[model samples]
Target: MTSNSLFDNTETAFKLKSDSELERAYFLFKMISKEPLVKIGTAVTKFALNINLPVEGLIRSTVFDHFCGGVNEKDCMSTVDKLFDAGVASVLDFSVEGKEEDEQFDSTAEKVIELTKFAKNKEAMPFSVFKPTGFGRFKIWQKITENQHLTDAEKLEWKRIEDRYDLVSKEAHDSNIRLLIDGEESWMQDAADSLCEKMMEKYNTERPIVFNTLQCYRWDRLEYLKELHQRAKNKGYKLGFKIVRGAYMEKENERAAEKGYKTPICESKKATDDNFNEIMKYIMDNLNDIELFIGTHNESSNYLAMDLMKEKGISRSDDRVWFGQLFGMSDHITFNLGAEGYNVAKYIPFGPVKDVMPYLIRRAEENTSVAGQTSRELTLLKKEKERRKL
Candidate 1:
């Protein structure tokens, strides 16, 4: 291999300096970028794997080392403290799976409430994050959101969802722990966004204690953000939104094409990027109306927002905005921003091994779905290995 320095010409970054860490990212990039459909099938199977495989051990050592906090709450905090020491905050996520049973729903709610209590006094754990599906069933949400009539039990189930969030949000409100709800599949998103807006109305009276995530991959979301911002202004309440380009790109397109509907997703990557940056500017321009979370892995996009902020004379420490990347993928952005005195956090997910497999598989596939060069990580590994040799 040529003597290519991975860190060359790069301003400061918090990436692997050791050969071992570099090697792990290189291999993980391959695993995650496996053909999309095949990877999902494999992920579902592996997610259900009861028999241990060699790959699982590789996982514990590689991407898991980079991404997940741990299998338990306390175990998760090791990274929290580490990032906190480096001036970064952590989001406490239970990483609960989407389940249909009432018991599971109740358990997830209790866990989040307990997590909120634990995070209340912690300076590093700034937000309590969870998926709505983690606390309810997807099919029911689909039905309710589609305006289809529901059975009495189905209606009752929806009520339970409201009640569960009420409990969790009440704790967050009383304890002053910020709550963030993750976005999900396009089919069930109407319910998720509506429920989140309701929570925003309920708890966001005094401040942005609850935030709804907006996935900008969809063409409509830019318009959606404008509407949301207007609603926040009209209601005289602060809006909290975490903006992401989105994760389910392929799935969203395939489903729409299969169903013979106009795809809700942007027609091209450029369109999505265009919308994402536009929404970023709109939010940054109206900082007093909203608290924005820049949740993304794209370096150009991160710098675009930051540059815009600087142009507008927005302080890096302005509590109105935040920067976030998943725990594992882009320490380059997360740690560097932290070092620059920006409010940054990693979305730290923690749960039992079985429950976190889906998240892990997505992490694996995400590394693959992008540009195939994969050369950056490869270069990093080779350099670190070379550095160690010298």
Candidate 2:
């Protein structure tokens, strides 16, 4: 049996962080713990950026440096090397959001392809990730999800989107790097899911080179997983999934209310947790045809995954399973798992400061809204600080 106190070891967790870095983490989490301060801070930062004020340096030095690896692939190498030194891998995430142009979509797709090539032959980076909306217009995805008729121009636009997906998937397959396609809001997710399924069918013949994100906050994800599994099995293709409780909870709930439709989200936090665990268990049960990437900051869920691996007698360094957390947050969980010799990776988001603000703001808000997340981070940081003193 794995020790229940495994994650309580702050020494292993913070060994890579210097005293100044630890203090900055403590201060950041302390500020994020205050909901009001986060709200005010987010607004002020957005406004300052909107006016093109001189806050990029300030933002980059604080939250940007803390949360992100750096502004580009070249800049992120130092952070990736540090993580690999601690036996953790990095997934370089280009986190620029909300682009609506075809050229921008092409650029984003090219970036993913470039990152895949960059990760080639590098043991430190086994994966690359991109958001669906980053490669196509959101309205096109929503229209396809809603099954509405599209104009010829829209058809051409969507064809380009498919080409982008194919381009990236092929690159990942050839480069031998796993690619994760992130989940988006429910209204547009159906189309994204369809596209990802197509990619998996084409590229996952030998192994899982492409992964689809499953936001388990949605009550239907377990059923979706089962259906997808059946389809993959029938077609004799592998499957890969990265499961998270989800982002965009408030946006999802608000949209359901506005549209007068049943909310897709689970009824409560407990329900979401159960759904996540149930889906995770399903993936664990079928590791032969399906690979698993468990992306979560929840300690209990991490423990459950570890326990399941133990029960199944899977090796600690199995290539078919990986545990992932974001770069700045969840150091305790990531580092502890790494110490135990589990396959661990950190999703290291990087982009220009202005372009990556949406991603960073969402992270801060998520830390504030997820009950006890900020406090847990604070407690661990404090414990590490005290340990250093002793």
Candidate 3:
């Protein structure tokens, strides 16, 4: 199929969405398309939940139901099955965030382990994911990255975090499931990158079971990738990475400005896009040694990957290369790619309605900030609706 037409099959895209679901998706995108509404809604929702104002039901019915798979892994099975039916797989992401306690970190680690076991033999669920901060305090990671000396107690805390990474990575390796380690803000990312590299050294000796994330919006990431690629080759271990245009551009630049350091982010949107495509091409070139899980919502980037695959004589269903999008958004890319015999997975975030609010809020904010993302969703939903009506 031509790159121009690859993602245009709305019928295939929305075939899995019932009329009601389609309408709800359209309405959600319509709401997300407005910046003022998103800002207001986020504040109001946070306030309501903070004051114990029974809004969970309201949230569970609308944004939560649309954006998340369910409140837990068990609750996500139906969505997993449905996506699998459409030839797309699911990556169960326990999207709870912002915990600092070791107990909470252990709990999150257990949850990831359980999800890995849950995905063990399941064809529908190919991978599991977790954030770095989900298993450790953000400050601790930042301290490590900044080369600040940690207190003796802090040394113990860091050990626990490393243990959690090893525990989860070992479980994923044992279960024969791929684990995606999500990238976070730049300050904490170096430590996380080191830990993930350690995991890759351990679990990826035979193959890529532990995957690190590369936020391609950063100007230095291509260089970092090249350095890592050379290291992996020298070390004789496979490398796996999930590359994205990144989610924290504004916060990244703000912190860099406040701290009087040069921003690591690309100068402009076009620069970030160019960087993303370049990183994808670099990974595509070295696919033999590096497995890639492309986590993107950009049509042009996806089309570029498709074209590159065709040019390289890579099989359409190559196991080393997979495409990913979040569950609620980008159905056109996910489902259409799946229909065309590509390996596609949706990152299905799941947690309690209250706990998942931060992630949901971020999603809404992201939709508003990302130029034309929500509008593209609206366009596709509207086109599918019109076609169905006809």
Candidate 4:
């Protein structure tokens, strides 16, 4: 705990009701910091073996309890109600990932639409999101992005993707539920962006019903934000942009090297941060032209948003912009900002323990990979504990 925090009457922290939450967050932080928990490398590595060694039980108790609303919609009743009591809402993300087979792709899209149905008539969950990879095989997605020729079978596979998206978007539009399309790896992102833009064109006319995630860590996305905004303007539709720093930095650079192409990453944290805040400013300056969601844990970036809201003369609760943090890591930011009456939502992804494993592995790696993220979480937890004298 910082001495400053102690004197600031850390009792204010109590209002967050995060004492127990911090304990769980801290434990997970320490546990995931170890290499054994964040498995990667050759598909059949020790990490993979270790993940299967009955650790699912432990993960369900700790991370699932803290992060997920639940594995299924009905199961989320308790968490949803609890968050509502705290003046926060949820963004339901069904976290089933990585299926190479077509049947698996089709099933994921079906589940996404089903999840949307489950959320209909439900007030607490305002939005539902899908990854384009959920609808198309990764290899097929790669082919489509490169504009390379594909076999007859591949064209059929691509059409199935279009059907899945049309099905999901129809349900979302009909139910009046917002759709958030998550960004993918750099290699396959062009297709994701194109599909998301197509949906936004169809659904985001008067209001932003389809939101596309922009990963600002890519050197070009800041400018792309403006380009997309301009396209939306020319085409006469509202633009929905969710600004995130990015997710697949390591894999992106690695693949670039393998393919012998220039890396698309921003090249430095400063550049990424600069681009991130710049995009935020751009969207804020044109709020009527766009809806913005700031999906980041960087404090400065988060505050930059608050500053923008003030400068634009918009209230904290104005729906034009939303502040988001992942499920467990930034409760202080999420809850505090929500407490201040800013529009906020937690990216609440849930699924069967086994189905969500890859997501968990990335999460474990995220806390460690993002510079100081682990220690920053620890420091907050440690502060709350000392304040509670626990």
Candidate 5:
């Protein structure tokens, strides 16, 4: 397909939405475009939910519907079917957050395994994902990061975390479902990365059944990718990777400031973007041993990957490469890429209103903070709506 035939076709992008739904998106994006409003709204919504106020309905109809799949696995099926019909795939992400108990971790692991099983033999659902922090204790990760000694009881607790990872990855391998380990705060990422590498060694020998996320916004990650590549080469296993600019920029900078250490994050968006694109190129050059999932909303990076694929004579249907955007937020990129026969999927997060609020708030804040992201979304929606007019 021609380059022009790609993402500019907003009509194909929003074809899944009804006219009223498109209008609702227009209004929502317009509202979120205001930085001050988003800040106040996020704080107020969190406070309201914490106080047991009845704001679920308002949230469910607006941002929640626009950004997430649904309130549960069952509720997400219609969305899965819709995207599949449009030639896009689905990655069901259980987006519940902020828990620290052993039982909670075990439950999260089970839910991840259940999602992987649900995806088995299902064409629409190609992959399932979970955050390591969701199933591993944050304090354990912190202590390990700081080189602090653990007591026997704490050692036993760490054993349980390892067991949970083994259970989930074993299920994914047995079920033939691809599993992505979501990236988290920098402090906790070393433990997660090690666990992901261990799983990749176990499950990704013949094919990539496990993926570790690389957050390119962190200045060290490009060098880190080089290290991971060397390890994969030495171990003789295919490396599965998901690349993103990252999520915890503000937190990372704040912590670095408070601790009087140089920040790990790139100093500017340009540096991050450049690092991300360079990583994309590096992975493309090593496609023989790397399976890549390009996860971003940036148009330039998306196009750069597409161009790399074409230049390398990689087929659009190549299973080793995929482009992913969050559901409902980047329909133009997701659906148009799908229309062109490129492997594409959405990160369709699902959970109850209260449980999913943190994810929702992040989406809101990200849109507001990212330069021109909200305005760009609004522009595309308006273009599509105008095109549909007689």
Candidate 6:
């Protein structure tokens, strides 16, 4: 494997964006960098939408354009094409959030299945993803997790959620496209884990057609992954997982504090970072039986994984090891890694702007809390602009 500076080349990284687009990205990040401004902006954006204001144009041109692929699956193909041209893969994530009706849940399930069919036989688009909470009520999931006996109607509702999972998994299995089930809060994860485990048992016996996400910020996820690994071995199935530092820190911490429970989150960022790297090392060490998709923006951890692959004498082009970052946030990691002949992909989420506002808000909040996330992006854009003499 070639040992290149993973993030030093701005040209290859920003080649996908033209000067105008790059400038827009810089301006957007600049706005996001002001912490108080972002908080105010988030509140105002939500209020405007609630009163049926015409803010979709503003949102669609800025954050939505940067973060999401488009308003629909067909609309995402242009992005899929561009990334594929650059040798990067696409995981088409249906980004619609906060749906609760039975009809809405069924529609979300069918949308996932349709994406699987669309991605079938497409080398550029290999994976389809969805969040369980998007398809079912969160309270139901929490109740199921607590093993509380459900009323007859709640039992039926739970069955509907399980049926949706079965349909989504079956479609992916039939289409031979991998499916990633996004993880949620700790209270609801056990139910998600159970449904995903059932899919893995049925579809993963042949290969890894289904994957469950592991959020490493949770203190218990490392042990959870270990138990899953042991179960995979005993059941004679390959374990597939997408690991991340996690996305729900504030909500988790706030809820734990409100409920007077010990937080499931790691005490410090360093602890979460340490846990993430350790889990990645474990996966690489057991690469023969496990497939790993690393979803992180941390440059050091990315390099650490590359070094581990080299140390283990694993080929950089190995199929089992893949890297992922969000569509418009971590172009440096995605494009540079793709340029280096490693398997890399962007999590390209698409949905109507109004429907995806919850996701957009979370992304904004994440940038605010991630300490220099926006500034880092702004710095890279400035460097590229300078390189281009713009």
Give the lDDT of residue 111 in candidate 6: 92
Q: Spell out the clash pairs found in candidate 5.
A: none
Q: Model 5: per-residue lDDT, tens digit, 1-390?
A: 247446678889999999999999999999899889998998999999999998899999988988888999999999899889999999999898988788988888999988988999899988889988898778888887777999999999888888988899899889988888889888888878887899899888988889899999998988988898899889988888999999889999999999999999998999999999999999999988988999999988998888889989999999999999998788989998998899999999999889898888888888887888888889999998989994
Once fitted onto the true fold, the runs of candidate 4 whose alpha carbons sit more than 4 angstroms away are 1-21, 34-54
| Per-model TM values vs. the true structure | 0.90, 0.99, 0.99, 0.91, 0.97, 0.97
Clashes of each: 3, 0, 0, 0, 0, 0
Ten residues in sequence with the least summed lDDT for candidate 4: 1-10
Q: Write the per-residue lDDT of candidate 6 for residues 1-390, one digit (tens) a residue.
A: 435576878999999998899998998899888889889998999999999999999989888998999999889888899999998999998888888799999999999998999999889988889999978999999998989889999999999998899899899999988888899999989998988999899889878889999999998988988998899899999888999999999999999999999999999999999999999999999988888999999988899989899899888889899999998897888899998899999999888888889888888889889986777888889999999995
List the candidate 2 regions with Cα displacement exceeding 4 Å: none
How good is model 1 by TM-score?
0.90
What lDDT score belongs to each candidate, Candidate 1 first? 0.79, 0.95, 0.94, 0.79, 0.89, 0.90
> Model 2 Cα RMSD, Å?
0.7
- Best of the candidates, lDDT: 2
Which residue pairs in model 4 clash with each other? none
Output the TM-score of candidate 5.
Answer: 0.97
Question: Clashing residue pairs, candidate 6?
Answer: none
- Writing each residue's lDDT as its tens digit, candidate 1 over 287-339 gives 88888999987767888877888889999899888999887666666777887
lDDT winner, 2 or 5: 2
Worst 10 residues of 5 by lDDT: 1-10
Colliding pairs, model 3: none
Could you tell me the C-alpha RMSD of candidate 1 in Å?
3.9
**How well does candidate 3 match the true structure in TM-score terms?**
0.99
